[model samples]
Target: MSQGVSPAAARGLKYRALRALFRHFGRMRPAARLRLGRWLGALAYRCVRPRVKVARRNLELCFPQMSEARREALLREHFHALAQSVVDRGVLWYAPPEKVREMVALSGYEHLQRQLDAGQSCILLAPHFIGLDAAASRLTMQCPSGATMYAPQSDPAVDAIVREGRTRFNDVHLVSRRDGVRSLLRHIRAARPIYYLPDMDLGRKGAVFVPFFGVPAATMPSTAQIARTWQLPVLPVLSHWDAATGRYHIEVLPPLEDFPGEQDAEAATARLNALLEQWVLRMPAQYYWVHRRFKTRPAGQPKLY
Candidate 1:
């Protein structure tokens, strides 16, 4: 959910309870907090079955070649990662900045630094992962400034918390999805790297049908357009929460060579989707599967979700 509460989701209860829970959770030592997170994760796994059902269908569509038994196992592991990520947010949101930096282990940061050092704007192609917020929030600790796209939450309290968490450090610009690409360009022009996520199913406006895990999913093609417009390089970044060690691993990969091809959105969109597939293979359980990725069907096709 990227800290954004969906319209249909249960609201006041979650944020209010977590607000009180995190107050104490933030005070606990890392090891102890993680232990409690795992316990809460177990409880969430048992309680949030409806969302689990959505994730299950997503797995069935993406990994049909894998055995059903294996998918079930992966599903269980995913919930554990999901719940652990939420619990760790107490540190991301309320704990000291030093603790936040300590908990996040970022690799390939030099790639981003190299670009910024050379006075070039870079775009971080971040796919949907449970540890995404952990990675993004941590990046702001070291980055001078940056901007990212997000769908605003419906509830005021939830939106305030999420906005505060993201902008706590670096005064990073938080552009609403309704604000469009112009706001992003302004940030890039100011030398702030745009943290871009193009994997979600946002319907047919600026998106095209692309093979995400071999399924024709509606995906935004704007990554290429934006890169081409600004003459910037597109580098991929992926993050995952390790439940065992209670640490977030953020990998900022090098740029995709010859990106923003002549076909631009179409070809570039396909390449991005292909990259997401490869990343999903590495951390299958860590990918965000609850989203209705293939919600936008082509001309006459029925919905997959």
Candidate 2:
């Protein structure tokens, strides 16, 4: 370490540099950003070997019937989507809200709007797609009041940046997952729509085993519990960055009807996974394949990763 520079100063310098870099990308034109992201993504696919393997394993597990050559082609597409999403966070985080709204095209939002107009509470089934952050921003921009759950980053500067960027517009509440269901419900009472991602493998705690792409995955069961208890509409939100247009396309599908009735959490969670698999099949490359979806297997079962 340099003897003259203080630790605080060093941290501040790095934080400022990160902020500058994000803003620099935010200010770029959409076409230019796509070019830069593709260039960087191509480089990353060649150099970032570990994540490539993780993604490849995920693809293999999910699509065992697919040919190796086809899977390899899909892996490259997934990496490009991932890298583009990482670079595009600048647009979702630092760009002007107006500019973000202009770039994002929302479809099938009438499903949500009708529910909101009818004074009914809604739970948005937003999965871990590449355009997740951008979709969250768009929801906050359009919805008057909303809530979402997240675990704060360990780094204070990074957490602060994320919190500020997401909550920049509207009355969007960021409830910590650590706070439990009470905190979530409290925010739900204060808000109408809750943006929930129930697909992550959050270990076995408070989760049930469900079939995800024909594999058992630890899945969240609370979506059904909350929906059943609160009589909230569970609407699916789909998002992806379109390569043909270099913009994000978001759609709010109609709420699921006659769901979770007289059914256990495991059954409900399986239904959720089925829906996710359908969407993922339609846009296989855009799904977040880098995550260890089958990390938590059933008891006495071998690990998939």
Candidate 3:
């Protein structure tokens, strides 16, 4: 009788293949890697029409006043940015720390340091920009100690790689979503800044419908709740790609003042959405448009995606 390899063995083989590919890409010159990424992105834009459609729909929803021609152009640019960021992950995950640091320029770090120096815990409100992973890696170098929650990848091998790559550079704790908010609060209370991404639609649970680009998006109120409950400062951190220089710049804005004081979760969430709109306006193509951000519609409302 012939026996087949187990599922675990098959997964292991796949993980090894992926790891080898990442290592190969990691060794290539940055310029060449980025060029290749752009080519791949262009190819994907043509082949993966569904994602393109989703992106286009998102643009239409967000920018109703903009002409269709302009939106299409932005959509193409967004794909390029998205692909570059994904391909660049090879460098971010496997490259030398010094090299990675060189590729990123950070501003407003003083704001973060001041909070740490004051012995205050704070929240790093990071949005879902294309360069988010790069920015997070860079922040690890400057941050004394930090912790963040991550939604685990379905593939165990991929999940392992992500966890390893994220924690490799800094003293950062990765909390699982299953662990819930309590684990995050425990880390924050220990004076480790929580690098929170509060801009996604994870459904209505622990979220409220707020205006994102004038559309009622299912926005998480956790950021406001966390800050208000713990009296922690909430700082906005945004990352941008400098195409001219082929580098990333992370801007850490100062803490929002007079925030969430006796304010309901919905009110605070709306304020957060307004700030995110400002950031998106500055770099429309850089924001992650492929995600169905408006997927979780209010009760009885038709799906936006």
RMSD of each: 3.9, 4.7, 4.8
What digit string (tens of lDDT, one per residue) describes model 2 on residues 55-173?
A: 89999999999999999999988888888887777887789877888778889889999988887778999989988988988888888888888788887667766776788678878
Q: Compared to the true structure, candidate 3 yields what TM-score?
A: 0.94
Over 4 Å off, model 1: 1-18
Residues 1-305, candidate 3: write the lDDT tens digits. 01222356346977677767777777888788779778987887898998998899999999999999999989888888888887777777788877787788889999999999988889999999999998888888788678988998897767666776787666788888888888887787789999999888898887799999999999889998899889899999999997666789999999998888777989999998999999999999999999889999999999877
Off by over 4 Å in 2: 1-11
TM-scores of the models, in the given order? 0.91, 0.93, 0.94
Question: Model 2 Cα RMSD, Å?
Answer: 4.7
Report clash pairs, candidate 3.
none
Q: For model 1, how does the per-residue alpha-carbon lDDT over 35-135 read when each residue is reduced to its tens digit?
A: 77677767866888878878999999999999999999998888878877877787888888888888898899999999989988889989889999988
Model 3 C-alpha RMSD to native: 4.8
Q: Which segments of model 3 are wrong by more than 4 Å?
A: 1-11
Superior by lDDT: candidate 2 or candidate 3: 3
lDDT of each: 0.83, 0.84, 0.85
Error of 3 at 166 (Å): 1.0
